[model samples]
Target: MFLNRKVELSLLENLHAEGKPKLILLYGKRRVGKTELLNEFARRHRALYLVARQEAYEGQLKKMSSEIAEFFDDDVLRHSPFQNYDALFIYLAQKETPVLFDEFPYLVEANRDLPSILQEYWDRYFSKKKTFLVLCGSSIAMMESLLGYKSPLYGRRTEQILLEPLKFREACEFFPQLEQEDKVLAYAVLGGTPAYLLEFDYGKPLLENIRDRILQKNTFLYQDTMFVLQQELTEPRVYYSIINSIAKGNTRLGEIMNDTGLEKSKITKYLSVLKDLHIIERRVPVTEKSPESSKKGIYLLKDNYFKFWFRFVFENAEYIEQGRQEKLIGDKISPVLNNFAGFAYEEIVLEYLKSSPGFPDYIFGRWWDKEEEIDVVGLDSSQNRIIFGEVKWKALTEKEARQTLNQLVEKSVEVKWGENLKSGEIQEGPEKKYMLVGKKVGGKKRLLGDGYLVLELDDLVEN
Candidate 1:
């Protein structure tokens, strides 16, 4: 199903609207709906779309020649394929029609010098003509390299889009009728993956859906996480160890090294590659002065599906192998499902704060010093306003929420922001705001009347 892609489709439309020699690069991870979004955009225009295959370079050229021939019904080119990159690009440069090449990296893999060749043709022929060309790929690392300073196609691309998985709010579109709590649980398990969400049967209960869709050996999602890793990594097992180590609460580099028994330098290098692949992320406290050099960074899996899969499926593979799905669900998943949903709840709150925090310009993050930890911290540099928040996946009464807010007020004093405020350079201190989010917060109106930002599940989903 095509859902929550109008923004991306509009972006492609805007680029196409430029009406010049447009070379667009659209790349992201697998099953992120890149192909579907492109196909949707193609429907609006008579774009010549081509998907590359993994074969010999000659075969790649001939296959595209056939596709182009079919597009124009050229009998001569149909009889004889284009000899080189120039001929294919020259032929395409003849028209101003938009063209999309899905999985463009496959062609590059078969032809190692494809980037330089395309660069030469683009500068000489295609750029001079009104040739609209798009190169799409699922290889995050390789596609990103094309934009690097040293790469051949670095400056040639007029537009580039790094598509990502749907956010918590967008992902809920797949389950329209699910209750707020159920929707949150579904999102917690499936994350924001379009392909993975499609595997679930919305009519069934969440547990049943998880059983029939994910636990079954013959299902698409059962082995999908492993397959994606295999396709991306040359050494999936080594990376798997690191991923598992992090899932087990090894947030520090030294902790991961000790757990995986890998050397420090090697782990750091692999972690860098993992970040580039969008599999993991490095986070520092939002209040840190120099974030990159803070020396307090922690690693987190960027994708929720990866986190869920590793926490449950990867750990209990034997349950599926031995046909003990019931036991696994009863003993493993059901027991800790709510606990798992807490993190997803935090994710939803963070994403929601991005647009609704009323900050003109701000950075959002979780904060901790030694003992005190804040679930949500937003700093608005433009107004010198700071918001300290506490989020919970559980329901809270007004009294409990007041206590939480009071505790947050105590911790707010600990957060040192804005050099001028701490040194008494400005008599009036920076504005401090208290916020709270939960699955259900009783007396939300009263809490809002108390001059605090409060949101519950319904408020979050509707927005």
Candidate 2:
């Protein structure tokens, strides 16, 4: 079930080969495969992997001592557990092996001094030895804090990896048995998380899987959205309101404020926390000069699973709890699923185009004004070229493709790139490129012949 992460594996492998003491800090959101990657790396080398849990400080230490003793085949050490982490870590430092502490934040939770303890041991013993240390956690905030100037473990890590979820294409690889469109639909619901993707049964109909595995009360993912929020935040209700508002299409700040009735300052703080957790994102128009300072920023739930949950599951929780799964799907989900997937499909198309060999080095994003919005915008600064693209989740005929392309061309003119170029802000007047991406474009050959770049869903998936 392991997929992608080739680059991450290579980096770990290189670290192993360095033949020196190393401290590697790895952190990511839950279900992002941090433990899996660490276990896989452990299998390839002489390593002691200990997964900490929510337990007393003494209990965790005893458990870790047992594992470390067993890993090093020391009978005496196993019989007599180390009283403190310093002693255990010092013993580990004597051996040239990697010691991986997964879910490290749990240990920090049980013992506030663990980071300082590790810092002291790492500086006194491990740093002078050939020991490799990996402290992995699901708490993004806690792990980042270890690198802060005031933290005990500051400057101790030789490398750090904030692992992220798989991309759309990699996620699609999980459901090879399903049709391309069905794969996209499943991704729209399950997102790129390996754990979530594996829960789905590709042999069944997509909706059937959704009903049985996600919508049902007893299912694991039924309450996953709330569970994740509860684990990451103290006040889940406020975060829920904000996420729900964004999911229900209150993307703008004012709209979210109006919908949630939360103060602007409070919303800003919650949004910052959500952003740190990788649950939501603040996006600005592609052409904006200062994105951070832009007043036009809009909020979007970046995690597909969370978006699907809030939009479909959370919204229809009453129906689901009433055992009306079929009614919920037909009345609430099916009619609007395509529209939801359309937005995600646009993002996938943009990702595919970004990875294309023909695609120049460009700053890729969407452009929007009060009246007009462009789904895909790529500004190739080196070549002084701009690409404007329209993405459709549904199939389009030749005539339809031409009409869409015409609209995209018209919208490209409305973009302020020309004015910026003329004002000597950008060196060259940009050469505009138009593109159309969709499930299927019937007149793709003709469109390409007519100097428009056309990309079908098949092309994107295959590439």
CA RMSD per model (angstroms):
1.9, 1.9
Give the number of the best model, judged by TM-score: 2
Residue-by-residue lDDT tens digits, candidate 2, 161-228: 98988888888778777788987888888888888888888888888998999999888888676776
Candidate 2 residue-wise lDDT at 105: 93
The 10-residue segment of model 1 with minimum total lDDT is 420-429
Candidate 1 steric clashes: 0
lDDT of 1 by residue, 210-284 (tens): 888888888888888888898889988999999988876788898899999999988988999899899999988
Give me the displacement of residue 424 in model 1, in angstroms.
Answer: 13
How many backbone clashes does every candidate have? Answer: 0, 0
